[model samples]
Target: MTLALPPLVDHHCHGVLRRSPDADTFTSHLTESDAPAAPGTSFFDTQLGFAVRRWCPPLLGLDPHCPPERYLERRRELGADEATRRLLRASGTGTYLVDTGLPGDLTGPAELAELGGGEAHAIVRLESLAERTADASHGPEAFVEVLDHAVAAATRTAAGFKSIAAYRYGLGLDPEPPTAAEVHAAAARWLDGRTPGERLTDPVLLRHLLWSAVRTGLPLQLHTGFGDPDLRLDRCDPLLLTDFVRAVAPYGCPLVLLHGYPYHRHAAYLANVFTHVYADVGLALSHTGARAEAVLAEALELTPFGKLLYSSDAFGLPELYVVGARVFEEALTRLLDAWTASGAWSGPDGERVAHLLAAGNARRLYGLGPDPS
Candidate 1:
């Protein structure tokens, strides 16, 4: 029998766009590359593209595998509100822990929760908070105090904190918390180089923000593995974080490694050895599409079931929510079914593991109650 998972808890994700994107914009969201597709080639040819073509049409009252043009046309016809509502509801997500770091005209957590028929919580971005408060403060010492205040205020309501240090300066940062004088000096340099809306990339500042968040005793999510042009893929490996992980172990702060792709096995190994570390295959699964089974298998190879969590990492488009959910449910069900059939795991054990990965682990870590729905 096919094992159906319970409603999912997306422990890491972003909100949907506020407006319906034109066809080109929609296509851009499919892949991680910032550049447009090469001449004469459509983004529709990718695994994620084909998965959307095959899986999303039925939600819009069309047959599966319909042409991309037809799908986009149907999307435009229904408009953004209708499309988002339909797709998010269909995804069967019971909760969303949204990362509010990326700047975009997207819904906030409460709006997403209402639209998805679930609950939502915020994941404060450490860099964004620093940037927002930077211009307001004149001196580096004041900047440090302002950022600390901001983080403390955010921790009161936010479910967790996220850092894109991997994207900004790679994961090879010195794990030791910087001295006050070092942070003040780094802040002065960052302030001198500041352009309006520039991101916080100074390594010392990044380390300071991470240590500040760790002190909150809240879960800290770090972007790892593959991402856009902003990061060096080779430098984004979770293995590079081994020293930092070891450094933060005493605080009992949970470190969630997000979207570890080619390095997923490495992330799983960290989660295996480090009692405070957790890992997920979020962006990798949606982009890998039909190959999600292999990625999920690698993620599961060494990680304990209780250490795995679910996330779509879905951004601009709601179709991604549907696609991520479908592929995950399909891939996980097949793996568990095969294991149970082979007698490698009992049926009851398979069911329990499925639930753990789907929602239980997230609930336990975040201190969330049962979904109201």
Candidate 2:
């Protein structure tokens, strides 16, 4: 019995490449690792690499699990636009909540929506907004005024907000909203020594950006668990965010923890305990491939159905979207099927819960409308 999930509301993702990528560039997007694969082992030797070769080829007019070289050759032949179109359309995602934070030669929300044959909404990255604000404002005081106004303005259009505080100053930082004095001093110090286009990394300023977004009452997505080398994995655990999660609870802002792999269970535990907390195995599921079922099982252990949302976290590659969706749906179907077969869950309950994970949870959390047809 298939799960027959609804079209997904991909609640957290990023845009695909704007131009055709060379082999190395394309493979780079497949893993969280920033470095190239070891000389003998290809990035294609990984689970995500295998998953893409398996799931994406059939969509691109080839047999499943074709050689990586063949897949790239065919992709080049089809061209980026055509390849991206075929893959995104086959993904079965109806709506995209795109993070417009990462800098690259990538599509914007509107272009991605059109290419994927779905509607798209923006999830403004708070740090990006603050950094841009800092770039324009000379004084600490003016920076505060400008950033506050920017956050308020973003709330009117963006579906949510995302913060990479985990990448900057670990999630272990003091969670309480920083006082204005601290914010001003931090801003002054940062701007004084900052080079052009320097990222926002100060702990105090990160707290301020977070609090400002919280004040907007938008659902805030926080990056947790695995990422590039910039992150300290020891510090990326969601448990480290307990104080901040608890502090943000009163403001009624939904905290969506993204890419919680090794820590997905902890994230689920947070969702179970906190009314405003939500979690997704976005980047994890895509990267883990065949092992996504184990990840999903762990995520489901403590999370309520309504608190688990669907997301691809696919960045710079449409194939990631294809593999992400396929792995998630397959993993979820197998999990629910086994449970229902064992009489642990009723058939109707299993169906309903699958739908919740696919789209319902995200719709409610983000206050989105019905999924696209």
Candidate 3:
């Protein structure tokens, strides 16, 4: 039987390209690797490519499982604007919480909402806010005052805040909040030495960004488990964040761990133990594609149903929107349907849980209400 879930709440995702991409340009964005593809092999041979061909082609007016070349040809036929609209509409997303942190000439929340026919909200990236704040400040003391005010202002109306300290200093840094002196000295040193518009990599400023975000009482989405090559995989473990989790508990903010492929189980364990902690199997589902069922099952093993949120983590390609949705719809239906078949879960329970994974849980977590429909 089918899951028949609600309109999905894509709690984390990025915008699609402004212009249609050539086949090679599109294939290149399919992996987390920064280096060129291994000799003759392609990122397209993976689950991500297969899923995109199988699910996204019909939206561009071709049959499922079409050749990559044919799919690209059809996508180009429809033009970029129409192709994006068709794909986003086909993804069944009801609301989007977009991260505009990554520098790209891509759509913002408002443009995404218009193209997709859904509600859209912003998630302020703490690191981006800090780097921008630093660009305007002359010294350490000025940086502190400006960043503090920026974090407060950014989170006031946003769904929440996000961080990539996992990419910068790694998650293994000291968990406690740093002193004002440490923040000032660190900011001064980094700013004085660097040229303008560099990325935020200073550990002290990262800690300050995190703690300041926690104080806002907004949900904090932390990238964990896996990402681009800049991250040290061993250091990205959610277990490394235990002290930091304890430190932020008093602030009454929710911690949402994003990605979590190899470490998804560890993220589940954190969610099971902490009241304010939650885990999102976003990029994992899209990256694993056809093999996503086992991964989804692993994510659900130790996670409370209410704490498991849905997201696409799709970037650059419109095909990712459909692939992310299809993988989720298929995997979730199979998992819960099997449980109900064995009498481990009731039919109604399965339906309710599937709904929570789709939209209900996110609604409660981010405080989004009933579907506008």
Candidate 4:
């Protein structure tokens, strides 16, 4: 179905780099060399971005000799051009949020700005203190430095920072999994040090960071629901955030729930109940099997009007934008059709729904102009 909606916004995407043309050759070499599979996995799945943590090596065309920074640097050297821009436009994405690679890779932001030419919107990823060290024993001093650097980078680029309080396990620089004490310690450190107007890791950190941001009235985005399969499903349960939502009900700042995957219904429930919490239908109806019409209908039934935002989370392949947009349109068409047949919504209401789903909600939420361009 053709959707008569505003240009779609891919609020979360990582299209800053394209896969190398020599991916197959590189994969073969890696398999033949010392980089064996991380147990129980085949070489083919490894090459196809199956294992989340190890996925970046092939996509960035990294040689074992090169560090990740250098690999991303090579991607920047290739850069986004007219053909890449065409690919994005054809994919039906008008705006995207590009994670500026990892810490110290601000080149992604420059590349996106050059490519966009002020025609599209982009949000650059800033490094968080949590990403600084894999170990938590180093103390909060280093973390404080990382946060300062992140704020400085965001200030320099007119971009926002992305933070993560806890990954699969612990915090700190150690590759070893983090313990519960480490997680709590890291959270406490972030809460104590963060100032007003700083970008947060995600809404899960809201309870700790909210009071600080609320004191400063800075906006915060929360990564809700599912993301890379490496993450445990239970950790992403939206219901786990009920206490968090209740805690910050008093001091308000715009809280965007990123992803909202399997928990779309729950996310919508929170959106309906809280003025500050809004559900972003970023990766949900796209990467996940939740894109079916029935899922969309259920989400719309649960979601209040104007609480939904569009996002792509388009990392790896740029084609994800088109794939995601098509899915969004299909699901939305089914929802409107069902609503119309039941006399629950009319043509005008459908038009409004389309507008809200497309850009109206995001424009208002992010305080963006009518035309992001």
Candidate 5:
């Protein structure tokens, strides 16, 4: 009773590493922690690690559930370029919206699209743009002018905008857009003490960045819930976004909350009530691995059929592309099949909903579909 889905649209992901990873780097992809796993326990024993072993090895010419050493050895044998190409091409993903904001010598949007044999679009990260623009300004006024110009230009070409405010200032910041005077004050203070490559965590600037994206009439993606050590899970709750969601609902801008894990249901509740809110358990799905079925079932609890979208939120390792897609396919099949078999949902309707989650909703959000090629 497996439900077949269309080629996925990976709405959120990043470029694979340009260089081949060593054993530690390969294992690092198995978890969200910035630090290594506890001394005795290995990240390789986790669900993600096992999923990778099962899904990725065959793509590299090894059997399923291959040993880590054999997997790495085979990966190196094929070389990074060939390995990445094979993995992404085998993913069966129709479109990729890659976030290039992270620091890395990774492939760009064009390269990613080229490699995957599909359309690729960029998603601008607000904080990264602001920090770079701030480094070039002399005062708050100049900072505002420069940043405004930069963001406007970037927005014109980008399919959407993204924010990591949860990782920076948390989701509990003031929901209102800053006034001109307040913007000047915050910028002045931040600039006065700004250091080279200093991170932007000021609540004012983060909110300002979000509001700026809102003004662009583009879909806005916000990093919410589980992530690396930089985030406080308690502070990343989607419920904290109530004020912000209410303020922006009237603007008709799509507010997409990415990677809602432990609070996925909370995010779904927001999407259920707000016309403009949407939720995806992307990174959470890939990281959860074997347990992604229960996670996906929960994400579907309160979200409307139209407001839920799909993404991998996969980064760094190219193998994640394969693992993410496999896990998603399996999880959706198991959930939807059971529902249909029990007469809870019609088979036809279930198939349609599966398509919507696979790629239809994403196409509507980012204005993408029907490959020109």
Candidate 6:
């Protein structure tokens, strides 16, 4: 089916530096070295270089020796290239909502803008407290400092700034998870009196942030469901967001649920019931399973057309955009075909579904001016 809609948007991702030539060589060497080796030793060796090992056991013999900074450096190296663009085109994406994990210098934004052909909606990540303290314990003050730098950097960048608070679950450098109270306290300090709700992250800090961001008329994106396997599936449940949604309802901040995963149904339910909550059917539909079509159909059953949006959450692999787009199209096709056979939607209705899933909903949610025909 031909997709006539705005480009797909990936709402969440880490724009950390890509692997350097040396790092690349190292990885290649490791791969080659372990190719004929025993599986246990190979796995252990690779695990040592991953950040996830902070929470879970390393795979094989790979030690989690590489620091988060190294990871970021590698991401930077990979993010700037034609490879990502090729992936986007292959995946049928025109617009990308690029999220640079942590706020740094305008280096990434400037580079992305150039690569995106001068047009890109960049959701710059401001204040990644979890990443900053991943390797060491930090006081609330340290969190504040990171926020300050992020805010200042955002003010300087041409790209739009979206605050990403707390890396709750097990995503940070610290061995322990951050508490709701700690998240709120740190947010309060960083926000300093500015509007709050315009950023994305955990729900614990939503009320204040939403209230603040709403005052400025900016929308907020909430990361829901699963992404990192290190996090408990229970913590990623969208159902737990009931109170968080209620608290922000009156504020009128547009709440975008990023990566609504295992709880795609519940995420859709919230989008269906709440005017403020919008479900982004991106990562889950792309990465999880071949049953993404079925899952998306279920989500749409509960979600209103206007409350749905598309995103890729493309990171790690630039080809992810293309991969995600292909999956989205495949899933969407299966859904429409089934709906048509079931008499829920006719041929014409299927076309409308195509338009809605492709671009209509995102346009409405982001309030992007009249369709860019």
TM-score of each: 0.98, 0.99, 0.98, 0.67, 0.98, 0.65
lDDT of 2 by residue, 1-373 (tens): 5877778899999999989999999899877888889888888889999999999999989999999999999999999999999999999999999999989888999999999998899999999888888889978899999988899999889999999999998899898999989999999999997877899889999999989989888999999998999999999999999999888888989999998878999999999999999999988998888899999999999999889988889999999989889999999989988999999999999999999999999998888876556
Which is the leading candidate under lDDT?
A: 1
**Candidate 3 colliding pairs:** none
Comparing 1 and 4 on lDDT, the stronger one: 1
Query: How do the residues 70-162 of candidate 4 rate in per-residue lDDT, one tens digit apiece?
Result: 643554565545334544555555555555534332236345535534234444333333343313324455554454444444544333334
**lDDT for position 46 in model 6:** 43
lDDT per residue (tens digit) for residues 1-373 in model 5? 6666677899999988888999898888788888988988888899899989899888888999887889899989999989999999898887999987999778888988887877789999999999889878888899899999988999768999999999998999899999988888888888887896898988888888999999898999998999999989989999999999999988889999998889999999999999899999988888888899999999998999888998888788888888889999899999988999899999999889988998989989888855343
For each candidate in the order shown, give its overall lDDT on alpha carbons. Answer: 0.92, 0.91, 0.90, 0.53, 0.89, 0.53
Residue 308 displacement (Å), model 6: 1.3
Which consecutive 10 residues in model 1 have the weakest lDDT in total? Answer: 364-373
Residue-level lDDT of model 6, residues 208-248, one tens digit each, is 33333443444566666665533456666666667767766
By the TM-score metric, which is better: model 4 or model 5? 5
Q: Cα-based RMSD of the predictions, in order?
A: 0.9, 0.9, 1.0, 9.7, 1.2, 10.6
Clash count list over all predictions:
0, 0, 0, 18, 0, 39
Local error of candidate 2 at 251, Å? 1.1
Return whichever of 1 and 6 wins on TM-score: 1
